[model samples]
Target: MGKKRLVSLLLAAVMLLMAACSVNMGEDEPKTTTDPGTKGTETKSGAQKVVFWHAMGGATTKVVDQLVDNFNKSQDKIQVEAVYQGTYDDLLSKLKASMGTSEGPTVVQMYEIGSRFMIDSKLITPMQNFIDQDKWDVGQLEPNISGYYTFDDKLYSMPFNTSNPILYYNKDLFKEAGLDPENPPKTFEELKTAADKISKTGKAVGANFAIYGWFMEQFFANQGAEYVNNGNGRDDLATESLVNSEAGVKVMTWWKDLIDSKAANNLGRKTDDSKKAFSAGQVAMILDSTAALKGLVDGTAGKFEVGTGFLPKPADAKEGGVIVGGASLWMMNNRPDEEQKAAWEFIKFLTSPEQQAFWHINTGYFPITTKAYEQDSVKENLKKFPQFQTAIDQLHNTKLNRATQGAVMGVFPEARQIVEGAIEEVLNNKKTPKAALDDAAKEITSKIQEYNRTVK
Candidate 1:
């Protein structure tokens, strides 16, 4: 053979061997791309983002965002986007519409009581499942607060902004009334007497309160009144509302006398308006949620030293329980496996004690995790600021009372409106407390009955 022909054959043989090797490597490795610029940080889900829906606003949002930022930076697994969806009602509406829809958020912040309905819907995964599946230590959480997102034997959500109401006072007004500013009102009578003295000052209203239904619920629980008939809103089988009972009526009557004797003023009942009234020195003492600490601090802004204490009890009020308030985080139903994994990762990140501490310290949301309270940073913050210390103290010995279990009647918010409307009538001198609550309770019963029928 000629030399040129032999060389050509050898070149073709080498080319064919190389092509065969390429085919085998392609089959074994599938396909993937690595950018040198990405610097070894895996995309985890490759640009996937999680949507978190919450009702937190103002400073609360700032606190939440900081936590979200921390989670994103800690790992690149998934990015979370939080949207303020008005109120819990508005979020419920969106959740109802999103059921089984593909466009909903992976996470939704729900009212603690309303979680019962969500649990029944089977539209979300229980947080306990995640904890166990991931081999998480439940002990890291505060025991009593665990049930905030739980129902029966399963937990459908994770406690986010859990809080309970407490008595907030204007210390300057307390001193003016010859009362010890540090020694706050301890019972309904003490509150009234201090209020009476403050009212006599002509500058301070004796007592201040907001949300009649919330007050009735809190006061009744404080008065040892059963809220639900069977076992005070504990059992799911409860068939009647006991809020219209003798104990309930008595508390309402006392509140009426405050208005009647002109020892107290409603001054228009809203959480914000009430805070403003108290901070501006229009009222001496206000019963509000410890969650209102931020607003109270902001409104006072060095105007007067403020003091905090647990909600006043009656001399005979139940000494052991106050129900939980605030909302929780829920994972929506039927997401893709990847999406579910991503969502669960995000949920775990947010519920961790470190994140809870960050939230509690910054936004006044009670730390859902126990470790947050025990942190040196949290302790330092509490000592540096009495406002923070008060809320912390309230939680130190709180009992998980069923009497204040929380309002779950579907039209509960509307029922509150009914009571507020009746309150207006009394505040306007159009009806007595008996007359007002009578009108209010009747409407509430109808609404409860109406909501009950729909649920069943």
Candidate 2:
């Protein structure tokens, strides 16, 4: 044959060999099938894998891992992977970055204030959807706790770690100051009196409240005050902030007065510092979440007796109650149907009475289900640390109302920072309580408007 013809035959033979190799490689590859309902790869065991992202850290992380393990072992249909995603703020930022991507979690634990934002983002499948489909009786959940996550008559998230603010005091200091250790202050005026006595007795600074905006919001709810207009954003979208209203002024004024009269210590803005002060016997009282009860009680063991009380309100204020605090589990819309279903199963398991009791005992968070109180572990826990009962009683006593339902705003996180700034200004004598709050309210209103515009 001619040289050109030989070269052409050689090239065609090489092409045929490459095609045969490709076919063999394709056959040798694992035969995999994707579920029509899922965009993810299935496990070899055929179990649907659910990715759970949580903001729990420290000791709580261990409990979360244990619960996930229990769920995985309970059945083999679904295998859940629980990931620690740092603090709530950090987790939220990471989630935002992962939006519209498959890298995001099937279920994410978002802080309570993020409800409005989550709803507005339209990135979540409302927990109510699953509840309705399954005909699940939501009445089993604590109304006060669930109310915070419900909007437009729909529950947007499953409450996991619910809590409320409470007054933590040193019983030893109360006795030393000639105050009734058994009868802790119930109102702001009474708290001031007790604080003054404690200060005068040279026991410790009467009280020290961290400049946490959540505390301000709780105080507003306790006094039947709305943090934002339009029925605390439940009746309709809030058009403006009510943080400078009469109720807001009352809280700020009391906080500032406590500092001015040397009845309380200005511990800046760190709740941790206030907690440390209280545990070390350097402060007679501090305001914190019920979740802090175990730590406070254990930390102060033998140093002093710890007393718990309902969050204090103004003596004349009525028709108010504490709003539920803490985070909830949200099902993401981007996840596949199978994955979402698996996530729902995991959520149910977490909120079940037994699991809730376990979680409540391990972590200081209140069990979202009322039935958890009936669990023997919970009963023994409450009896051992009676301070836990104070939180339960406070939650049950809270009146279900627009104000107590808590405010909803897409800019809630930002709004909280503004309120904290106002508190700092008032405490530092930079502005009067009313003036500072008014300024903060105006800024928050502007932010709300901006958020609304963007979401729209």
Candidate 3:
């Protein structure tokens, strides 16, 4: 072969390899090319562009993008661009850093646990302000779902990805344990009894729930117990945590007892691990968010029948309820009137029955509106995946109260970690439930005071 010809062949191969590597690298990066005129880093879009910053990725990202596309195509006055802003923590961090600057999104989807911080930021325009100004009828929204974001009797953010923690069981394991598959436990004591029976079968771990703080929050609400003082911090800023109260102790004690008896396996603090155990049929039952319904169904396909019920109560507690979980949509304030109005329009559209129904059917998150259940797609979802209905019924049955409304604290995320650490300590036999919870409460109170001082 001629020397010049050999060199030409090598150059061609090198160019081909570089092109292949570029294509692979693009897959790992976020799709910032959705709208070339404005990159995601810049908070403000063109006059008509409504920059929507979100934390959705993976398969869920497609659903979010589709929703954005539908909203964008439906109107000519406004262009909606959905940007993936990394994980929830990263999104909050970026949002906090970008506040007070023009480099912030007009609309943001924030998680429920970050509600307090969002409220404290003073960077968001309350949804109720726009609803009242426009005379919008918010009667369609599920009161329980919206109740979480309500402050001073006014709704702040529009609930988007609402959910509830529910008890999921494996019917196949129930049958093996000689328990009725149709009737799952309704209380912690009953769950322990049933778990003991299932454990005896040696077919699977009787129960498994992640050592997550959200579950503890639900348990506190179930006992009509507040997670913080001053009416769960609704009346005023919370200076302390009440998660170490007697009611919280009862819930933690029950959880520790289950682990001690070997009836329930401890999955640590990772919710995914617990989900994996349940999906693999290693755990007969699990307590997980309603959002896990679709994933659980797909993960356990052709394996075992999955049954869902409300999160079990404390057996003696009456007139108690579960708090709403999940994220909501907040519109950034100080934007132009047109941008604000467009943001409100997008929020209204997203929470509308039709759109919410579509979102619920696709994402497995509970729809924010009661009317969403009336939509054909949602109705079909209920029929095909009956487990989805459990959360709806639970929400409807929940008692409207301060505790169930959830606590609002600026250091909520930190408080959640403290609570989770307490739960882990009890589950690992490092401390008694009371001791662990009390310590957690003290640590959380200190953190809250620090956070409040800085924010103020």
Candidate 4:
């Protein structure tokens, strides 16, 4: 062979190797296409990929994972990836940072108070759009639960895990204090009386209500009081805070008086701490979400009998109901049409009667759909935990009103923090209840105004 022939053969071999490398690299890369709708990347299997960010932790996380796995395995057209994003606050913070970017989730499970902020962000495709497009029956869901997420006759999000506040008391302590074990306190005065009597028995503190801001909101609603103006921020955007109104004064006064009279103990702001105290029999009564029922029951098993009752109100306060407290699933508009539709499918699966029944029984959160009650599993679970009946009855007995509908404000998360700080101030004797609440209301109103300006 000649020298020129050898050099040409070597050059051709080098070129062929480079071409092979390029082809391999192309195959290894993800197959993604950018469209006008920001459609997500398709998997190698040709399935649409949907990312779901949720705040569910502990055992509930396992349930969520299992549900997602089931959905992924049930079909091959779409695949969902569930990611735990710490607390709801953490998730929202990350979401805010990821807005207008591909890093954000296709679906996010945000706490109920974040509804106004989510809507104002204009980043989400209102769940109502999908419902209307599909001609789905919205009536199948619990009206009370749906009412919270509905604004201007539109549903912005799908209610996933729904709950409300309830009073959990140790029936044995009531009996020991010479009070009726079966009849729990229904009014604030009665609660105070019971707390005083139970505390005097030396069994445990009469009550240990956590200094959580959510409790303050619920208390206001229980008194048929709106937390903000503009019809609880439902009729229109709320411009002011009503946290220092007459109803607010009554709640703060009664709460402070209870602690001052040694009828109840303030357990700081962490609800988990108070729940642990109750489970350890260190407190006779406590206020908590209905969602905690299962954990509380199991934690106190074989130790004491737990009795549940309605959230108490001022004796003279007209009959008002508790507000629904929980999170919802939001579909982001930044996702592609196919990905958004896939996320919607997952949302529907999560709210289905069977899935909702399982979720309710396992987590103690109310199934957003009323049809879940018809499931045998739900019925059996209710029979096993009769105390849960109070939650159901309370939800049904609640009249649909502005107070019960709950407040909506873009600054709700910040407002909650402010309210929590004011509560701590009052509890620590650093300020008068009126003074602290007034300051909090002012701060919250200012934040709301800022949010409004930014959105506009």
Q: Please list all clashing residue pairs in model 2, or write none if there are none.
A: none
**Which regions in candidate 4 have their CA more than 4 angstroms from the true location?**
1-44
lDDT of candidate 2 over 192-255, digit per residue (tens): 9999999998769999998888888889899888889988888888889999999989888898
lDDT of 1 by residue, 1-456 (tens): 443344233323322332232111000111212211111233356656777877665446656667777777788758777666655555566655564467688888876645545654556777777777889877776655665455565666777777777778888888888889999878778877888888998877987777445666666666656665555434663445565577666776677778777788876755667777888888877877766677687778779988888777777765554556777788766666577667788778877767877887776667877777777878876776677676666666656555544444434455555666766676677886677777777766765565455444
TM-score per model over all chains = 0.83, 0.90, 0.89, 0.88
- For each of the candidates, the C-alpha root-mean-square deviation to the true structure, in angstroms, is 18.1, 14.7, 12.1, 14.2
Q: For model 2, how big is the CA root-mean-square deviation?
A: 14.7
Which tens-of-lDDT digit does each residue in 264-285 have in candidate 4? 9988876778889999988899
Candidate 3 residue pairs that clash:
none
TM-score, prediction 4: 0.88
List model 3 lDDT by residue over 26-110, tens digit each.
0112333232232222222453878888876666687887787777767667787787886665576566566447888999988
**Clash pairs of candidate 4?**
none
Full-model lDDT for every candidate: 0.65, 0.82, 0.79, 0.82
| Candidate 1 minimal-lDDT segment of 10 residues | 23-32
> Against the true structure, whose lDDT is highest?
2
